[model samples]
Target: MSVVVLDGSTVRSFVADEAAFSRSVDARFAALDTNGDGVLSRAELRRALESFRLLDGGGFGSTEPPPVPSEVAALYDSVFEQFDADHSGAVDHAEFRDEMRRIMLAVADGLGSQPLQVAVDDQGGSFLLEAAEHEEAMIAARVRKESKKEADGK
Candidate 1:
């Protein structure tokens, strides 16, 4: 059976491509499309942000504030703007899928020679899964430490 080795970014790509992930993203977009107009204007986007804050236990009057990092928020805004092509302030399913495909291809290319493949055999799947699991643990640890530092005012 052909075996494929995947780098950390490739694993992230696969995770993003998962059907469950796609459905979750689609649901979020649908929810953000306020007014039933099938479009998400800037005001709708702002409402979505507020909704997220509320969902995450950070209400409008809460002093705790939201936990999203500045870099992450910037990234989200950039992506949202990019997807809202034509300046119409909305992204249909086609646009969303196109953007997602663009992002996936870019991530895959950045992974270099570490091509993430679907193996034909069980052994190959197991090997790749184990490697990805280890890498995920390492990434999680690093993220946790960084988050702690950010919380500590460091």
Candidate 2:
């Protein structure tokens, strides 16, 4: 695991092993595949959204909620399409792993300047080290300012 610290209080960890990352992706996909139909349909995606909302301390009943935002729906569809490369309308384990690897590589490339390092402790916790580059630091500052402005408006 590698840790990225945004500030004194905000830190996040990322698994270093590609296999571990793939496993995590597989687990999430399995949890969201409500119908066990191999492919994730719109209904399954809705179920995933509702589940995530509940996990984030929101409320959702067994019945599906009203229509989701068009942008959100389109994003979901696009992700599924990308993973289901053969147009099989379903993503097998291998396909899922491959797509996950590609996504991870892209993310790693984006953060190339802030390279990640993994350290294992005695308690078996993986520690992630993330050192922000000049550009990343600037971006973070801008984001913080924008967030503060939004909060003040509220």
Candidate 3:
């Protein structure tokens, strides 16, 4: 399902309170780290995305089901590249926390007074995936509609 995530107040609050934000980020990192490994790999990130049910949805019709696992992995790759700071191929809790703080701060600061709400809700950074999915759906639907008309000799 598509969801709306408002980043202004929530992010601003997190930015304003470093301790609380750290705790919150730590809790999230621990969850995503899984296996108590203290680091998040591509596999871990994929698992986390699946667990959050963030890897799929947005009216994907029967002809075109939600993204396959590889597509999700590709998304994770881009996310990891951006978040992995140290080139360790894995993201530690500290790195995760710092990155989140940076992203939240950017949103809060860059957008100014207006609340920034991204429908993609990918947890961090761009909503490119979400926007692309919606756009593709619209295009697919239009194609299907036109095809049906042609088949009916319209």
Candidate 4:
């Protein structure tokens, strides 16, 4: 696991780079589309989401009881519906990309200006981790350039 520092701007900048964002999202989509079909069936999406454990209760201590199975099912259904768009019963790459972009932007908004330390698994497919890595690479390149310029002057 690696800890990455990221703020809203970091994610926003990543999203703004349309080509990079699309490439990442497309790669993820391809992985999820296990059947090699061009689109994601509801079962495929639900299975993937379940594997991620995103539906697991937040770490926050809640006084309320855990959600019943039906409620969980409904929530998953709703999420699938959102990604389906056009009521097409399946999620195409375009639909998946659009929804992922919206979801990432919402996460960015929630993060606001506060930098968060996130521990991510090296093999975990996280877009935020990718953004942080990209930011670090850019900073490294700039530092190298400045050092070379100073060396040339001396």
Candidate 5:
């Protein structure tokens, strides 16, 4: 895990970079499509969500026991419904991308402009990680530009 300082603008900036955003999202989608079918079945998505422990509110870093099985099932269904845009049984790449974009934007809106120090899994290809990496790259570029300017002046 790594701690990164980020604000809404940082996430928004990452999302605004279409190429980077699409690549990150696509990579995640591909990973979730475990069957190599070019889409995610309900089972595939459910398994991924369950493995991440994202199906229950209490599952995330909480010492509380998991929610009832039915409750978790319903929550999983709701999330799947959000991703399955056309009432289809599966989530195609476009649907997955659109839903992910919406979710990330919602997170950014909730975060607003307040910078927060968040602990994120360094190995995960999560949106927060992408945003943090983006911010770091921008900072590095600025530093390199400044150094070049100073050297040229000398």
Candidate 6:
């Protein structure tokens, strides 16, 4: 038998890779972007969070969703605050993408070369890896922009 283990840095690098992160983000956004609008309204966000609460307790496939838990209800506010980086009360794809990038990169930074192997079971679902070129550029630019903002704010 052969075994291979990836360190935390390796896993972090995999997530930091712009293309890979964005694909995961994209799929998540697609599911959450109800009504086919490019932007996520506050209502859409609240509803999504409500759905998450139900799913968290094995409520999936149920005709009626369970009530939101108190913790998730509180988390809903913080999550929106984080996701809407500009706090404009709405999250467009760019803001959402940039915010996600910033978060993933920050986590990678905090991992700081620690060792942590990764394993995956696809379970037949697919993850799109080849993002549009402009998407890559957008992430890079947003990262730079947020970095500058952080620096300037500090």
lDDT of each model, Cα atoms only? 0.59, 0.54, 0.66, 0.88, 0.89, 0.62
Span of ten consecutive residues with least summed lDDT in model 5: 51-60
Off by over 4 Å in 4: 56-66, 151-154
Sorted on TM-score, best first, the list reads 5, 4, 3, 6, 2, 1
Per-model TM against the reference? 0.37, 0.45, 0.57, 0.87, 0.88, 0.51
Inter-residue clash pairs, candidate 4: none
Off by over 4 Å in 6: 1-5, 46-71, 118-154
Candidate 3 structure quality by residue, lDDT tens digits, 1-154: 3454443444565455566556667767877777888899878876765666765655546455677878777887888887889989888877887787787678666656564445554554232333334445556989999999999995
Q: Model 1 over residues 1-154: C-alpha lDDT tens digits?
A: 5455676465454545456446545665676676777666666776655543433535768787556677556755776788777666677765665665566557556766656565534431332353355455667989999999999985
Preferred candidate (lDDT higher): 2 or 4: 4
Instruction: Give the local distance difference test score of model 5.
Output: 0.89
Residue 96 miss distance in model 3 (angstroms): 0.6
Candidate achieving higher TM-score, 4 or 5: 5
Tens digit per residue, CA lDDT, model 4, 1-154: 7899999988888888888888899989999999998999999999988987765665479665666789889988999999999999999999999999999899899989989998876785789988787778778989999999999999
Instruction: List the candidates ranked by lDDT, beginning with the highest.
Output: 5, 4, 3, 6, 1, 2
Pick by TM-score: 1 or 6, better one:
6
Query: What digit string (tens of lDDT, one per residue) describes model 2 on residues 22-68?
Result: 55666767766767877666567556545444333224554555445
- Which candidate do you rate higher for lDDT, 2 or 3? 3
TM-score of candidate 1 versus the correct structure, residues matched by position: 0.37
Q: Pairing residues by index, what is the TM-score of model 6?
A: 0.51
Worst 10 residues of 1 by lDDT: 120-129
Candidate number with greatest TM-score: 5
Candidate 5's error at 109, in angstroms? 0.9
